[model samples]
Target: MGNGISNVKPSTERSEGGEHSNSSHPHKLDQFRYKVLKAATGKFCSKNLAGQGGCSDVYKGWLGYRTATPGCGLPVAVKRIKKQGYQGLDEWNNELRILSSFHHPNVVKLLGYCAEGVHRMLVFEFMCNGSLEENLSRECCREVEWSKRMEIAKGLARGLEYLHNMDPPVIHRDIKSANILLDHDFTPKIADFGLSRFGPQGDKTHLSTRVLGTEGYFAPEYIGTGHLTLKTDVYSLGVVLLEILSGLKAVKRYPNGRRIELSQWATPYLNDKNQLHRVIDKRIIKNVDMEEAYDFATIISQCLTQDPRRRPTITQVLHSLQHIESKHQHFA
Candidate 1:
């Protein structure tokens, strides 16, 4: 098992009214009936089960491309929360409220939702490529070449920049690779907003909230004091960068029963340009340009900086990634 621990503690600080605020209004999103989703997913058959999390089960479904009616046009993912699961009605409401308010190409699209009776479900555009976590595993790493990996990184940065630059700013409390899905073209889309919240507003430097997030992805400061900041996401982004570069999970356990955190294990190599190749995944290393790999390493190091304040903004990270892509023919 990889080091994916979910600390589902909700934040104590509530966001004020704004674009990022949890509001009752769902805007333009369709209100899908439970029956519609049930039919689309074949009554949540095991064969249609795309994936399962601690809180929900995701099933593959089909809907009309234009009208979004069941069993007609495009394939979709239907996420239904289990009763007495880790995530409850509150998370369902929060995800619906937040996602409905915003739309971005790099962020997953919430096509519709169902809140009928005791059921809660969300319908999203189907991602043919699945989660980045799946693609990066040893069995599938070959599918994602170095260029695709860099593009995925850029797309994630773009998504995070969009979230962080909102009117009141938004913080994705969870920002691991598993939450990042790849479309048919391998474009990365940030998904799952059950733990998202608005960023610190006005004069506040940070929000004192419950410590929550995946274990290996949590920032030092967040884990130490439960103080949340936009940089906390940056730290997670760094862990993702390390994952992309090394083709390893944020936490990997060996046959010896020893677990190694990717960020902690790769930091020394990330800091040393000459030794940067040592941390890169061997499968893609042959085609990797040393200079480009070094540049990517530099960005990862900045994001993994011990001091949260020292981490670069998501926008800056995007610019740096774009800059690297611009100069490299290595990125196909």
Candidate 2:
């Protein structure tokens, strides 16, 4: 991780050889990206397209020519950037730089980029299982079991650990269920690094000019001061953990004129055994190990602490999850 000063300001000059530097020169890879986009989407075939996000559309594609090994052809997902202003270019570059360099089993892999003309595109490993948000909120899907949820939590933590422990540490400004993708076997992978930033070497805090992220997941400090850090991701992860356990959205308004955040609503249940039953998802309640559930809840509480300094590191979080899983096995 790049540790400079606690409150060092970000440089106006973008880093060279990375996505940030390429933002100003769209001509460099515009044609290539366009070709890939066209090929991936079959001349922009709407049928093959998966979904559209705020700034880009994702399409399912197969790259028969590029094989990691013999007969191991590449099945990829292409993200085609929509035309916007200079701000859009920055997002493209950020995704490219961050995803290109980020190599982790739990992180979505960036195959390559198509940077042709005014169009920009990114190719990633296709996630067969789709986003975590879809599995949680969408109907007709099988409920995720406790063991599967634990696996997802561990995978996410491992991915975050990589970012937090980088030489110049990376901060995933956006960490939410919607940004987490799963593979064929339901393995979790962190996707979408457009809002990410590289923290200064040794710096505890980094200043952010713009406050951008999904509502209810932002860290208290980041929301109040516009400062970003590794802990910010931890806070979001905590919210995700609660959602996974309780089958609740991070921000939900109850019927009794009360709007409660997932973290807040679940906190009271973490410590009290009587309240624990109330916080768990109804689908898994009967089958879940009570001790395992309590342990997992405690870990989530630590991650969601209001004080950034108190939030457990991703490494610590992973260890806790692993311990809980082992404990569950022992009792089983």
Candidate 3:
């Protein structure tokens, strides 16, 4: 996060755009000084633990005070990768490579990293508000206004648009609520690039890879045929959109005792005039416009389209949400 690495030894020469000219990018990224990280994170103490996933443990830390370049210190999230086989190694390296190259306001900032021997860690700006999932929990109320929700949706759509508009178009294979972190102002930042992949180029339409994502959020086609594309991410975002609207899990229990997926259960009533409210959470519906709800639901339905090609692009989604936001602001 400070001046370009001087204390930490370089693993290899960096390319013009931060990307390695070759495929081997694991060791080519900026490595942080181990001692600095230890001091910042209190040596990975449990009290500083922010969260843990299957691949890594995230610890909250501070930096810059001792470096003599800033006031007080800046908070950072240090993700320590858990030991695993070859596949885990690849995911770790992929996250390092993808996040290092990305620079979007809605994308988590990767300040630096530590890739010494068996140790693999990534340093990112700490999000004070935690994740979207925590903010949308059952305890939440008017704090998450309808306008704020729309802003979050727009931010997420913009993040996806950035990924999809890249040279080869990167696909964030996993776009669940938990991966969307929030800043102090509640602005959403898309995190977790370990499952990200570049979409096929030229005449190729899709890449056939092992389907990997949270259950109930996977696009039907991707789950059925393992065919992945930008639309695959669109479908997952649709499920998240549904969660934002309904305040329900991607898959939840209904009174009928069947576990109804947000997509499966909400899709049928999204356009039904008499049943639209059945799927929306009651918390913010009173404050939201019905016309806007229907429009938003329509977008969600289009994103969850069974046919990937039939789904709207991330750009389209962002435009639609922004238009809605504009109307709401003018009328407010």
Q: Pick the candidate with the highest lDDT.
A: 1
Best by TM-score: 1
Q: lDDT by residue for model 2 over 1-332, one digit each (tens)?
A: 12211121222343334332212211211124465557655676787788798888888776656432222356778888777655556777787765655556788877677765456777888998888888777373778888898889898988888777765778888999989999999989999898888875553456565789998798898889888878888999999998888877888887897776777778877877778889898888998988788888899889889999999888899889888878777877
- The reply for model 2, stretches above 4 Å from the true place, is 1-33, 65-73, 138-140, 253-259
Model 1 C-alpha lDDT per residue in residues 136-222, reported as the tens digit of each score = 999884458898999999999988988888756889999999999999899999999988998888999898999877979999999
**Candidate 3: minimum summed lDDT over ten consecutive residues — where?**
18-27
User: Which regions of candidate 1 deviate over 4 angstroms?
Assistant: 1-27, 65-72, 329-332
Ranking by TM-score: 1, 3, 2
TM-score of candidate 2 on Cα atoms, chains taken together: 0.84
> Which candidate, 2 or 3, has the higher TM-score?
3
lDDT of each: 0.84, 0.77, 0.81
Which candidate do you rate higher for lDDT, 2 or 3? 3
How much does each candidate deviate from the true structure in C-alpha RMSD? 6.5, 7.7, 5.9
TM-score of 3: 0.87
Q: Model 3: how large is the Cα RMSD against the reference?
A: 5.9
